[model samples]
Target: MNSNYHISSFCKIKNNEVSLNGSVIYNNENNNFSAFIKAAYKSLETNYAKFFKMDALSKLAFLAADVLLKNEHLNPEEENNIAIVFSNKASSIDTDRKHQQSIQNKEDYYPSPAVFVYTLPNICIGEISIKYKLFSENSFFIFDAFNAQHLLDNTNSLLSTDKTKKVLCGWVELDGDDYEAFLYLVTNKGSIIHNKQNIVKLYNT
Candidate 1:
């Protein structure tokens, strides 16, 4: 794998906590992922109305991506060349649970297309791609846990491709009131080497 890629910046939201670049930015007393996400959104001043309509999986991914994508180091000239690769343990399981609940019984059956839209794991990437205007390669993977080796390998492979310039890679998982997202921007420039060890260290931090 080419070592040209570097980690520009990263953000982590685990449980009721929020951190950026290994520093704690927000810590909530209550263990509510929704509240924590919205608090971070308001604090960051992300004025996107569509955020409300997104499922928890998309919201988690969008919030983390919003943080990394805002950096000036990201060149708009090659935005389309920026690919997104994400992994998660749940794979939109929280939204799936809700959708299942909505149709569990005929007496209360009211299936929602809105909720159904996010049943697929890749929907979060779709939401992010639409919001950020990324038209290049994008994919989502499901893992038992954050497999640093897989992420590192795929990122390196994508960057090795002549078509891809930079990549937004990370993990997004949510289940009911529990959620965690560790996202990073990998570019040809930055201080930290975009490798497995450092990626795992950043996620752990």
Candidate 2:
């Protein structure tokens, strides 16, 4: 693993608002979750002229990728090492709920394949990769909660292999009535000035 690798920037969205913009650490000033969701839906409407009832995990991943892709410093086309490693606790439970609901009602037993496809947790990765045109290693994991050690371990393993030059990794978790997301753009080239303390300060800010 590249010991030199550090997180450059990250963004998170949840509860209908952006919890963090593209920053090395958390920033409460940008943590209006409801507003973030509104902005994301607006952006999607403007770009795609369509929208779906996306769950918390999907919303968080899409918003994070949007911020990452727009970073002027990162060159996606030139960055062949770019990859995505995301995790969630619920693992598309919202989609499963809808799918089940569709089958529960005999009058509405028609299942939309489009909706069914998103029932998998990794579908969010596919959505982000398609948006970014990233044909690189992608993975998804499920944990009971935000397991920092697991994140670090998995990311280090990926970086160690040198198969990916850069990794976009983080946790996107949602439980009943609660949601949180944390993402990082890890690269060996850039420097990270923020540590845990810095993260706390930024979150308080």
Every model: Cα RMSD to truth: 2.1, 4.6
Error of 1 at 151 (Å): 0.7
Clashing pairs in 2: 16-33, 16-34, 16-37, 17-33, 17-34, 17-36, 17-37, 18-36, 81-165
Best by TM-score: 1
- How well does candidate 1 match the true structure in TM-score terms? 0.92
**Per-residue lDDT over 1-205 for candidate 2, one digit per residue giving the tens place of the 0 to 100 score:** 3457677666665434453354332233334554455556565442432224555557667766766656635454653457888887788886788778777765756887767877888877776776566777889998876665666666667777877767788877754446666677777655563244333433333
User: Model 1, 54: alpha-carbon shift in Å?
Assistant: 0.6
| Candidate 1, 167-191: lDDT as tens digits | 8899988888878899998989999
